[model samples]
Target: MRAVVIEQPGTVSVQDVPDPIPGPGDLVVAVRGAGICGTDIHLLDGELPYDRYPIVPGHEFYGEVVDVAGDIDRARIGRLVTVDPNMPCGACAECRRGRANLCERYEALGVTTDGAAAELVRVPAGLAYDLPADVSDVGAVLTEPLACAIHGFDGLPRRPQDRYLVYGAGTMGLMMGLLAADMTSEPVTVIEPNPSRRALAESFGMRAVSSPEEVDPDERWESVIDCTGVVEAIEDGLGRVRRGGVFQCFGVTETDAMVKLRPFDIYRNEITVIGSMAVHNSFDRAHRLAQVWGDEKLAPLVTHGYALDDYAEAIRTFRDGAGLKIAIRPGGLA
Candidate 1:
C-alpha cells in the first residue's frame, strides 16, 4: 500500500507501507478521497499535539468497505463510507451525557492513530457511515468539516431575521456564511482579507468585507462568528456584534495567543460569548444537507484536486492561493 506518513513534526513523505488488516471489530476501507483540513496544517506546523511520528496523516476521508468481520453487515462491502474520525470511550462522563465530541478520553483517528491516507485503513465498524447515494465521494469527505460548522452554529439559537457576520473566508468561514444564509432572511456578511476569497463569496450572493476595521460603526449584526481562530480576528469581531447578540469563536488559536476583552462591554451589552469545539450530532445534519443539495452548492469551494502522487502540489495550491477546499483522490477518482 502507498501512504503519506508524517515522519516527524514539520515533515511528511509519500511511501509504500503495509496494508491494514481488520481486527475483530474493525473493517478495512479502501481509500477513495480525502479532504485536507486546517488541523492537518496545524499538525504540519507542529502546533497541535498528537501521537508519536511515522503515522499516516489524514481523517477527513471517504472510501469503500473492502473487508469486514464480527457480526458486522457483510453488505457494507463496496459501499462508500465516510469516517467519524473521533472515537470516544462510551463510558466517559461526556459520552454518557451525549457529548461525545468532548469526550474525556477522546481519540482522533488521524492524530491519535493512523488515518486513511493510504490505499487502505482499518477502523472500528461503529464509526463508519455509508455515503448517501446522491452525494459524490468528494462531497461526502466534506461531512466532517461541515459538521464542525454546524456545531459552531448550534451554540446559539438562530432566528430567521437575525443579521449575521462570518469573519474569515476560508472553507470553514465560507461554509458558515452559506449555512447562515440558508437559515435567515438577514444577509450574511463575510470578512476576509484575501481578495480572491472575498470575490468568491460575492459570487455566492453574500456580502464580503476585507476587514472589521473597515465595517461602518452603524452596521449592526445580531450574531458574529469568528472562524479564523486567530486571536486578532476574534478580538476584532467582538466589537461588531450588537448588544445582547451572540459571538461565536469557531476556531482554536495558539496556546500562547491572547485576546484582551473588556468585561465592562459584556456586562453593559449583555453579550453572549460562546466557543464551539467540534462536531456533535452534526454528521447527520451535514449528511442531510449534502444529500438534498448535492455538489453544486459546494463545487465552488473545491478549487483544486490531485492524485496521490501529487500531495506536495496539492499543499502548495492550498497555501499559495485562496482556494476554498483542496482535495486528493487517493484512488484516482480525482
Candidate 2:
C-alpha cells in the first residue's frame, strides 16, 4: 500500500507501507479520496500535541469498504463511507456532558492514529457513515470538514437573516459562507487577503474583499466568523460583531497565539464570543447538507486533485493557496 508517512516533525514521505489489517470491530477502507487542510500542516510540524509520528496524515476522507474485521458486519464490504475521525473516550467527563469534542482523551484518526492518506486504511466501523449512491467523491471528501463547520454553526445563534462576515476565503471560510448563503437565501461577504481566494469567494456569491475596510465602514455583522485563525483577523473580526450579535472563531489558530479583546465591551454590548473545536454528532447532518449543496455548489469547491505519490505537490499547492479545495485521489479516480 502507498501511504503518506510523516516520520517525524517537519518530515514527510510518500512510500510503500504494509496494508492495514482491520482489528476486531474495524473495517479496511480502500481510500478513494481525501481532503487536505491546515491540520495536516500542523501535524507535519509537530504543532499538535496529540499527533503521533510515522502516521498516515489524512482525516477528511471517504472510501469503499474492502474488508471487515471479526465481529463486524460483512454487509459493510463495498459500502462507500465517510468516517468521523474524532473517536472520543466515551467515559470522559466531557463526553458525559455531551461535549465529546472537548473529550479529556481526544483520539482522532489522522492525528493520534494512522489515517487514510493511503491505498487502504483500517477505521472503526461505528465511525463510518454511509454515503448515498449519488454522492460524488468530492462530496464525500468534504463531509468531514463540513461536519466541523456544522459543529461550528451549532455553537452560534441561529438567525438565518442575520448578516454574516467571514474571514479567510479558504475552503473553511468558503464553507462558512456557504452556510450563510444556504440559510439566509443571500450571499455572505468574505475578507481574504489573497486575490485568488477573493475571486474564488466571489464565484461562491460572496462579496469578497481584501480587508474589512473594503466593506461599508458603518456596517457590522450579526455573525462574524474568523476562519483564517490569524490573530489579526480574529482581532479585526472581534471589533466588528454587531452590538447583540455573536462572534465565532472557527479556524485552528496556533496554540500559543493570543489576541487582545475588551471584556467591558463584550459585557456592555451583550456580545457572545464562542469557539468551535471539531466534529461532534454533526457528521451525518453534514453529509446531508453536502448532498444539498453538492448538487450545484460543493463539487466546484474541489479545484484540484493529485495522485497518491504527488502528496508533496498537493501540500505545496495547498500552501501556495493555488486552488480552493485540494484533494488526494488515492485510487486515481477522476
What is the Å distance of residue 45 in model 1 from its true position? 2.9
Least accurate 10 contiguous residues by lDDT in model 1: 132-141
The superposed Cα distance between candidate 1 and the true structure at residue 170, in angstroms, equals 1.0
What's each prediction's clash count?
A: 0, 0
For 1-334, candidate 2 gives per-residue lDDT tens digits of: 9999999998899999999989999999998999998889889888888646788999999999999988888988989998989999999899999999999999999888999889999999999989887777677889999999998988878686888999988888888888888778656889998888888788878899998778777788899999988999999998899999999989978888999999998999899999999898899899877877774778768889999999999999988878788889998956
The residue pairs in collision within model 2 are none
* Tens digit per residue, CA lDDT, model 1, 139-221: 68687888888888888768888999988888898888888988887668998999999998888788998987778977878
Give TM per candidate: 0.95, 0.96
| lDDT at position 308, candidate 2 | 92
What shift in Å separates residue 191 of candidate 2 from its native position after superposition?
A: 1.1
**Clashes (candidate 2):** 0
Q: Lowest summed lDDT over 10 consecutive residues: which window, candidate 2?
A: 291-300
Q: Any runs in candidate 1 off by more than 4 Å, and if so which?
A: none
Model 2, runs deviating above 4 Å: none
